[model samples]
Target chain A: MNKTVLQIIRFVVLVLFQVLVINHIRLGGYVHPYIYMLFIMLLPFNTPKWQLLVLGFALGLTVDLFTGTPGLHAGATTLMAFCRPSIIQLISGNQKFENIPEPNLGQLDGMWFFRYVLCLVFVHHFALFFLESFSFRLIGQVLLRILLSVPVSVFLIMMILYIFKRERKRE
Target chain B: MYNLQRFILKHHFVILFILLEVISILLLARSQNFHRNSLVNTSNVVVGKIYEWSSDVGNYFRLNTANEQLAEENAMLRQQLSIVYDTASCVYDVNEGDTLYEYIPAKVVNNSTNQANNYIIINKGARDGIERDMSVISTDGIVGVVTDVSRHYASIMSLLHSKSVVGVRFKNNQEIASVKWQTNNYRYGIVEDIPTHIVLQQGDTILTSSHSKIFPEDLMVGTVEEFYPTAVDALNKAKIRYATDFSTLRHVYVIKDLHKAETDSLKAKFQ
Candidate 1:
């Protein structure tokens, strides 16, 4: 499959999995896994900066529409997309992450990929949670939600990254 | 001019990003673009379909829990129905001339207690003799006021939700206040802006005042859970434990007075 078709398929499967499956897996309280971020993280490195932003916004807005949080998810995901290039460079300046098939644990390995994803995921989720809670004051409750959500989101991200790692090993 | 055009074309990706960001920022800042309602956007259709499918899937999983709850409620309702004729409506015990208090039943088809600006949807609508501004209550206490009515469904401003401001009095005392939720904590909220002259205690019971045309004279809200008298301002704040367990609430009554529309119209004219 070509890049666009593969990307589209990946997006559909991941988002469907998130809304249909992952969102339902709410662990007790506020710790809901956000496997949806895979859409943004999976965008090919060589994708144009503007295209990346738009795609990110589209993916986020989609999530927001489903979740009933208008503009919040879009805003958070767009921020991640905007900073994707910087994150790649920060992770490895010489390696040129663009030529790679997609983001994977094996490709950006030895905790480089983990930390890279960790930072971006936190940024995305922090923006989302904060924006939704904007009208209300940030009590300990708000902090608690963020702390709870991070681990779930990280686990999902790692799982998706592992899939990419598997695909890369085949090549 | 050619060199400038080439430069612009070379940096077009950056320009596009800037433009897109500006659009998103604009939507965020101005809430009502009317035509730009996110619910009607391209993303919405896809997301809506996915969410509907997800809700269907999720509801299946939650059905077991929901079944247990329904069974418990059925027993409670059956018990209440059995004793409907025998029990006294008023707790304080009325004197000589007291009219029979009537309750208008309503079923909540739609409920949103988790959201900030939440509303409850009742199956009763215009056809069911429902109208806007009617007070909704459960046997436990006040639920909300009917805000909108259609042919089949009426929407209510849920008491647990934010933006619910009902006029209330404290323990048959001098001060009248508005009861509103601080957040999603439906069990508790503050009776804000109560006057200083009203002496308060920890155990003092707060009730819905009759001043608001919605509810009648005195209905139980909850006991004063906590209080902080104003250090600077005259009005004090006190947290109230709401009577109804909102999470477990099932049935409710829509309080409709015959004179509600007239009174509502008169109030609107003055405003």
Candidate 2:
């Protein structure tokens, strides 16, 4: 499949999945995993900085539209996009992104890919929860939410990667 | 001029990033402005419709609890009806002019108890005569007040909301105070402004007062769980365990007071 077309399909599927299914899983009112950040993470490595920011904005705003919070998702996801390049560089040392079309489990080594996804997911959830609460009083609760959500989101994202990689291998 | 253009070209990504972030923050600020803008909320048509559909599926999981609640309420109502009817006298002592309130049953389509100002979206709306400030109650106890409405759905500001305050008093003494949610825990609320000298017991029941037209007088609010008096003024402040278990809430009745408009207008004249 064409990379652009594939990314587009992934965007739609992930957004629908996030809003329809994951949003309803109110486990003990504490953990709400946002796996839609995986969409931003899976974008082509050589994608322009400006395009990445815009895509991130669009992704976050779409989520906000569904979740009823206007700007919480947008701010956090945009920050994630801005920090992505730095995180990729710091995680995968010396290997330039120019040769890498997309960052997936297929091309990147398992340990580095896991680290990269973990760091970015952490940043995304941290920013998302803090922006949603926007309060110093419930800082403890907000931190707990982020702590509970990060691992779940990471595991879900990696599962998607594994499934997609297996499908590609079969093709 | 060339140097400036080069700088602009080089830093445009950073500029764009900041610009988008600023726009997002502005949107966040606008939505949280608390002016009760109905247009931007989740209870609007598209989102509400989707939630209504999903809730249909989710409701099945909560069926057993809903059934139990209904049965308990029915038994209680049967006992109350027996008292009101006075079976010994078939003619009864009830008057025709005593009707002051009506109720519309609604299904809870979407509810959240985790947020600071939690809102519940119910299947009822303006078309069903649900309007802002109408009181919502589950079979168990007081739920919240209607805050926003679309044609097909309405949003309720749940009692768990930080801004939610209910005028309440001890059932035995009729000593009035207010209850507000000060913590994220959905089961509890804080009581404010009770006189220090007012006697309190740990298990004393609290009821809604006639203080606001939003809720009817003497509706069940909660039971006192703890009491702490201030040192200087020595006012009785305490914690209450809410009667309605919001986590298990599925069905509720939106109370429509027939005399609310008249009372509100008359009160407005004095103000």
Candidate 3:
């Protein structure tokens, strides 16, 4: 019950933050960070596949609702959710998920967990910026948006995870 | 039926994932339609209301700059007001076929300049008599055209968008050409189809051509930053330094061309 409530709260807060605050940010005309994908990244290891896909779609659609870009976010987040299991197995050497109720820095090695988040974020952002551009003509600009946005978003997600996860674990 | 049910149960997750993804791609393509189905777009009531609230707070911080811009425009208008109407100028001519245009003031509540297809959201919409294809302009120069509108909000396809095309000409010579964004820097646009024989010197003033009723004749567009002939056939192409700084745009005017219906109906007869 506590976990379900926390996830719901995170979803609401992240979506509001993304639309209200981060959407307004225009850092040097590039770094538009989207940290809302952190919700998908932190889901429990035993999460049902159908539920993961639905949650990812919901998150992306909520963002698309505000940004006015239809399907760009939804497509990218769904792709991330679809590929999450493969990425996890590659990172942890096919370790059984039963040992880990949730994929966190506490259970997974720090470097491995970092790599997992980095890869998923890259895939998510890659699909997003490319789908948004949808043309090879502006490949330079699209690559620039991805390169700049990914690092900023990753850093923010990691900071939030550390702070929030530690507090939750204490309780 | 039994076999199909077993297959569905086994691969339900994969099927759902693919289904959602396909739906998303379709939505993306639909949004790109030329008609721009506004119902599914950002101009919808719920999202539009949220943006309006956010812009209300954001517009406060920009009050000082907006005031300065309005003051500067007011001073310029005041100076023009003092000028006696010149009978010699065509603008003053009361010809039978003359078309009159009216302006509607609006605030730009949401805008993006970085995208390949940039769009602006204004505070006025259908209730304000804003119709599709009406030209939007800032105090300085051309801004964009209205693509879609709901009850109280409208979305403009900005001049910086890759697909935007505006008819323009040289202020000094009246030599006409069409300007289009080349999906590059927002500060510049390319003027295509100028004849090779014409010499376009740098820093020449460009203005909206009278060829189109969308914009009034001789409105400032931009100055020529560079000009050259295409390698293939000596076709003259000039790069224009756009007048409106879209990044800082706040307020604008939507023009209603009163004679549009008459002219359009007349032109349709030629087809």
**The candidate that achieves the highest DockQ relative to the unseen native structure:** 3
Give TM-scores of chain A for all candidates. 0.88, 0.94, 0.92
Question: lDDT by residue for model 3 over B90-137, one digit each (tens)?
Answer: 566545556588899999877876566778888898999999889999
Q: Candidate 1, what DockQ?
A: 0.36
> In candidate 2, what are the lDDT values of residues B1-271, reduced to their tens digit?
9999999899989999999999999888877753456545543787778778888888888888778889999999999988878763467446566678889999987787765567788888889998888899988789999877888888888998767889887898988889999745788999878897886889899999988557999888889999887878757689999999888788999999998878889989999
Please provide TM-scores, in order, for all candidate models, with all chains considered together: 0.69, 0.87, 0.89
In model 2, which runs have C-alpha deviations exceeding 4 angstroms?
A2-5, A24-32, A163-165, B1-9, B41-43, B87-98, B229-233
Model 1 agreement with the true structure over B1-271: per-residue lDDT tens digits: 9999998899876776676656655555453221224343344334434444544554577777666865786798889765753575454343544434545776554454444445565666788888777788876777888766666556676786545677888875747888888764657878878888776888887788878666766877777888888879888888888886666455678876755556679989989
Q: In model 1, where do residues sit more than 4 Å from their true spots?
A: A1-35, A133-152, A159-171, B1-8, B30-166, B171-174, B184-187, B199-223, B230-233, B242-260
**Which one wins on TM-score?**
3
Q: Is the docking of candidate 2 incorrect, acceptable, medium or high quality?
A: medium
Q: How close is candidate 2 to the true structure, as a TM-score?
A: 0.87
Error of 2 at A90 (Å): 2.5
Fraction of true A-B contacts recovered by candidate 2? 0.67
Candidate 1, residues A1-171, lDDT tens digits: the string is 577787788888887777556654535444645778777776767777888888988887766555444576788888888888888888776776555666666665648767777778887877666665654575566667678888878877887677667765765
Instruction: Report DockQ per prediction, comma-separated.
Output: 0.36, 0.56, 0.60
